[model samples]
Target: MKVWKSVVSAALVSVLLAGCGSNAGTDNEQNEVKAGSTVNLKVFVAQPRLKEHYDKYIEQFKAKEKADKNIEVNVQLEMPPADNAPQILKTRLASNDAPDVFALHAVNEIPPFSKAGYLEDLSNQPFVDKLLDSVKPSVTDASGKVVAVPLETLSWGYLYNKDIFKEQGLEVPTTLTEMKAVVEKLKAAGITPFELSYKEAWVPQLFLPLTVGALTQTEHKDFVEKMNKDEASFSDMKALFDVFDLVNANGTDKALEVGADDGAAAYATGKAAMWIQGPWYAETILKSNPDVNFGVAPMPLNDNPDDTKINLSTSTSLAVSSSSKNKEVALDFVNYILDDKDSSAFYEALKFNPVAKVHTFKSFPWVDDALKYVNEGKAYQDPKIPQAVKDESGKALQGYYSGQLNQQQVIDALDKAWKSYNKVNK
Candidate 1:
């Protein structure tokens, strides 16, 4: 058995594979080593609740490594509490005890790691050619650099209970007006209409991407640019606020009383009829109650007839660590997760939409529909913004939810933070 399959470096360059090096002996020679040296790889991850997603894949990788190269791969999946992963990672890096590979949320976050000289450019990884064009931007820098492998493509929607819809005699609400009506219907039927976890604060930022989605569709394709330039504010979200009033209208305050995990529980238990969440919640929902019927729909358009924000754009990406000693391995790993059938299957099992177009899903029509969302010109990714603004805005929303700040106060906080972000990020 060939332990390490020889990777002949081609023109693509996501990782600097040895075969591509001009003087690294020959590809075949470089693929192997003497009888018994240890070639171990350590990985760090910040994505919580994804232990199962990586555990199995790492097993496959390890099996291949041992069979092909007499190499022993030591993989450690570390998901610091979601809130603390970055801080822990920074602390570890400072101590020079950081894992060779790690996880990050977006490209802007990647730049900081890259600037610290901790990542390898992934433009030429083996799987690069297999990615769907729609997902390319998720893992890319402004200069077209593929700094990391994009593991999944995500979209936001109301993860709702079909059972509740049936019990309430409600169909999928086609528009924001319709959704509001549905919310009222659910409330009258004694079901809490929405699940919101304002304690975590980041819950509302989910609305930001979707709100901007609507804004882009209606009167301002440059809303993101304006936000980035600090010339605009979340104040433009008044119409979207209508959805919030509808959501919280009927004592959904229980949502704010608990953390996100419990809020998810509230919905999963059939207490709450709807939850506007990313695909990440699928696992917990299934584990808690596989019998519950659920469906996903993009955020509905604003109820006001004159409103124009029709698109709801949400996405996720992956970036490579600039500090890997095994750039080839890192790139190969990224490719497998992004595009390979087996790897994509693993992710599909994890409930994330694969970024590659290759994994044709004949069973789940919804997955296919989500992929076509961008092609239909109905949705898009937000223009890259600064982390500070994202964080502070999330904090502001949390404050508003807790009544610690009024709507105006939230807007003021967001406006000031965004202006500051523009100065530093730009």
Candidate 2:
């Protein structure tokens, strides 16, 4: 488990794991469920908000398995709290208590999990051919093995109130200058320019992927690789603060006290004209206010319009555990996740963008808004930044918001986190 331990440490330097076995099981084992036997399959996901959707899907899968294979599956579906999920999952993996099938952020988690031989190779699965070409690379490991099922094909930046923008006679900004003007206009019209949700570090941490993706794809080419090698510094990307500062300064009041759900409520109720969040929370926001007219747009990172681009990514994906005794049933369940007949409905129910060729449901307006950028070639793949660095940025941004740390301190913290990640990973 030394390699698994290193993966966890490199990705989360702050969260330590006890060492265990690096391998889950040998590939020589023929893992399958006996016909007519009841199998207990464990399925873990980081999204607790979509428990109902998953429950329904699992029931469907159970019925399908019973009818097709004469096998009964009692799925133990686990949806843990988001903040503690990564730590909990790492602990479970290190202790050799891995789930049969689990969900992870494809680009961030697949590499390490595959390197540790925790993920079963899924390249030859039926769902592989069903995946869209755009999302294939996301689920593929460094060695080119398809290791996961793409679940959330994402095109995101900032979620904005379309109706508010219309009422204020403001259009989505295309550059830093236009964005500043839009902020001022919203403020002058007695509207909060942004929704700041800092109680959960991950919410504020959204800036890292959005900011880093856009800049690295355009002006800051090779920055991610350089940072990974400890050859670059966040000090060089100080332009990020131009928007981060404006967002924090113009956001709603009592931001530090507000968590993501509360922030969604405020945004849905028009407390702010815009929120720097992804469409993944649209379901939550609609729950708060179903009529909220939201749209997604690329955040303007700099004066160059070319620097503003949507983030195209497969954010969440499903993978089978190689160590599972019931790999047959687990892989069957994973393949069924993208079943042509049911996948579109499931993705539609979850308000997620389609990732597979089988998904034909029309996406929400906000998703379409973001996809317009993707369709027009104004999008960049989400950069592969260490999870530890993203976590550090979230904590650092919270301090930046509280005036406990200045811009330089935040930059220094990120640089240090990247260096620590490189050390452990190397």
Model 2 off-target regions past 4 Å?
A: 1-22
Best by lDDT: 2
Prediction RMSDs, each to the true structure: 9.5, 3.8
Q: Who wins the TM-score comparison?
A: 2
Off by over 4 Å in 1: 1-35, 86-98, 107-118, 304-316, 326-328, 338-341, 357-377
Alpha carbon lDDT of each predicted model: 0.60, 0.83
Error of 2 at 152 (Å): 0.3
Which tens-of-lDDT digit does each residue in 357-394 have in candidate 2? 88898877887787789889999998898777776777
Error of 2 at 159 (Å): 0.9
